[model samples]
Target: MSQRKRGPFVSVQLMSRWRNIVGLNVGMGEFLHKYPHVFELFVHPLRRNLCCKITQRMRDLIDEEEKIVKEYEPELLQKVKKLLMMSKNGTLHVHALRLIRRELGLPEDFRDSILRTHSKDFRLVDLEIVELVDRNESLAKAEVEKWREKEYVDKWLSEFETSYAFPINFPTGFKIEGGYREKLKSWQRLPYLKPYESKEVLRVCTCGGIERFEKRAVGIIHELLSLTVEKMLEVDRLAHFRKDFAIEINVCELLLKHPGIFYICTKGSTQTVFLREAYSKGCLALPNPIYVVRRKMLDLILLGHRNTRSLEDLEEIKEERNGSVFRTNVGGRRDGDWIVPILDSYDQNAFGSLGDINDSKQPFDGCESGRN
Candidate 1:
């Protein structure tokens, strides 16, 4: 809806055209009506036909998210640069990046704004690929390396274990069968090549054993998720880079196998993989400006129509809609100053484990399990 240039509202007939694409099992009108807090339904002033638009509050949240993205362009640029450096050939397909652009906190015009403006740092090849011109050795460090260093120094873990260990954060209620802990500990102690290390070295080391090869694949995925703004990505989107990253194992199975390090939410039309360590009770362990803005949007969606408004509040919304600019308090804070509080509790049983690879599939509701 935000991408439409005609106006904020779209005709109900027009929106219905995308019902199949959006995977709506019910009528578009019905679905829109269900979320009255997020979508406002009204007759078009000129056309005199029913149309729908995101509520004023939702529009404000979207604008704020865009502003936050613009403010973090510099940091996002470095993140993209580092991602290209971590790639096997110092390049990433344009389409693959577009698939997760929002997760990476990139502006819509990043191609021209970031890549073209910084010609010294990036190059566009045949308009299909983004290649790094100069790889910065300093930026070559993977995020997991820092975690390993911290564990070695702060936690007093042995260098051998810390060097290859990943931070495990098993979801609450995750079942650990007998011998699983010992097996996990031994796997953690196994050495593997880092994601940012040379591919030639990784190729030579993989010949030693399948365990080392799989562990290296895990490190690659861990580094990839850490580079994202949300620390999550669609499972299918990750498959697009399997050949590029040399992940021979089925991506879904690999994630399912390591319940502690990653969580796959099998909710909605797509499967999403979340880095467990990056989240605490469903909220980001470390929130950034962009993430905070997005969280505000989520809070608004969750608010639904249950949020009661007095006459004064309705009048203020009307005045704002009529272009009478003024600040108003929402939930005891000024609209511009509002920050959604982190959720205190979540469903412990929302997360389901396969128990073992041989175990039967279990119901998983990632949305309820991962609050953010």
Candidate 2:
């Protein structure tokens, strides 16, 4: 709906053709009408075909979200800059960035809006690659280091233990076998290369063993999640950058191994990895502006049809504004009974072909064991 130029609406006929892509067994119009608060069904003034538009409330929420994202552009740019600096070659593919752009709170057109505008900080090496212009020493510090510093100072832990220790938050019902805590503690104390530091020696070194190597990879994933607005990302999306970031381990299995440091959610079709410490009771411990705006959208969705005004009310409001009474059956009509008009002004060519739109709703099921 936000992508449409004419309005926050799409022709029901146009949308119906791709209903299967969204995994809808029912008719597209039937499914849309189920959520009246989110989608407003209307007859286009000229085309006389069924069409649906996002409710005014949804439109407002989307506008508010875009405004917040625009305001946070500087912070978003810094995140991208930091990501590039953390990469093995100080370069990241544009496609990889796009895969995780929503998680990073980057604008849809970040390539031109952010990279082109901030040419001093980012350079387009080629059509597919973006390279960091200058690595900031201050930004080189990994996010996990702050927690380690706090643990060392506040808890009076030894440097060896705290330097590499990750703040672990095992799921509520997670089981710990005998001697597991001691082994976990020993593993935590084993020092590994910092994610931002060069990995040339660590890559070749075998004295510290595979445990150290795996921990470093975990740190890389942890730092990447920390950089995101929500501190979580789709595992598949993260796998796209495995080559770029040198995460040689099986991403899913690695996440499963460290259930305390990471929470893997298979609630939906896709697997999402969340930094366990960054969330509290299925919510962000520290919500940023972008996250807050998105939460508002979720809140709106949860409202369902509770406060939705009927289509008759909308027509009355429109009539009052236009000073004309149009005889249209805009309300109290049975399903598939009313003929709704699709706007002729909407350019059919605007969307070359309807792409797959995933509207899968997966509510927060809380922390579950990775083994399950």
Candidate 3:
């Protein structure tokens, strides 16, 4: 006769205690401990009887039991199969047999076909179908991300959307509404005063100093004429314009419409000084008439007293606007007394002869202050 392995030397009391600890029936633990050979003796017959030709009701019961085990003891199916190879009790053996039959009855061809058709990697077959699905979803997600990145870069460098936009709105009680923004844009596009490169270099002067004109200064004016150029240019450009032309000629045209100022004689050393500065700075000074008008207006706005209608008031406004002490009462008394003629009979004769002229020599006294 073949000899069997000895059972554990556990007493009944110890068996009961072990059963309580393992949450098994008290009698079941003791019986299992006392007759370890019973598994080998009865499990095979019990498995054959319970699983063979099972009825529909028995199949349903097994399916329900399998679902419960899957939920609460997911490892039970796998552990029981492994344990069956070593030793088994009728109950555990029956459970394992039913699981094997159910698994075998599954649509083996359909399961394999689905896996092969849908799986991103065949190596993942041992994992649950949900896990395979998740991995494939991740791959699809990666493909989508790649497309998005390509689109972003393609759109980022495209020039089609580079132009600026402004909307038009109609306010209440207002008709004939359109976008002033577009009008402003059109105005910006209008050509600004260019450097004497627009012609030949013209002489420029300031009362205090002088310089030669250059294209760069004209470029600064061009930049100031429009918003797009303004954004691209530097603050230092404004500084350079201020240093070169105390009264920006572009804005001088706008100030001319509003009056009440004085003009000082712009000939002699003053014209020479301005011409010299214009040459050095590479920008053209305004026509003498415009310059005189702007000069008076600036003085009145800046220095003349505050009352809206007094001579001193006009002088103060000019000063405030021009940052210069020069004032003029050139306009007839009918207009404000703010404008005064600065050019004498001699000055007027020289300007009339030199209309749109560029003579470096001091026209008034025919003296050359020389290149300053």
Clashes of each: 0, 4, 57
lDDT values for all models: 0.70, 0.70, 0.26
Query: Per-residue lDDT tens digits of candidate 3, residues 190-263?
Result: 33222212112222222213211222333333323221200112222323334323223432322121111101
**What stretches of model 1 exceed 4 Å from their correct place?**
1-7, 172-178, 308-372
| Candidate number with the higher TM-score (2 or 3) | 2
Model 2 stretches with alpha carbons more than 4 Å out: 1-8, 204-207, 310-368
Alpha-carbon TM-score of each model against the true structure: 0.81, 0.81, 0.15
In candidate 2 the C-alpha lDDT for residue 224 amounts to 95
lDDT of 1 by residue, 192-241 (tens): 87787777787788888988988888988998899887889999999887
Which 10 residues in a row give candidate 2 its minimum summed lDDT?
A: 348-357
Instruction: Give a tens-digit lDDT track for model 2, residues 158-233.
Output: 7877777777644334567788777887777777777888656656643568887788789889999999988889
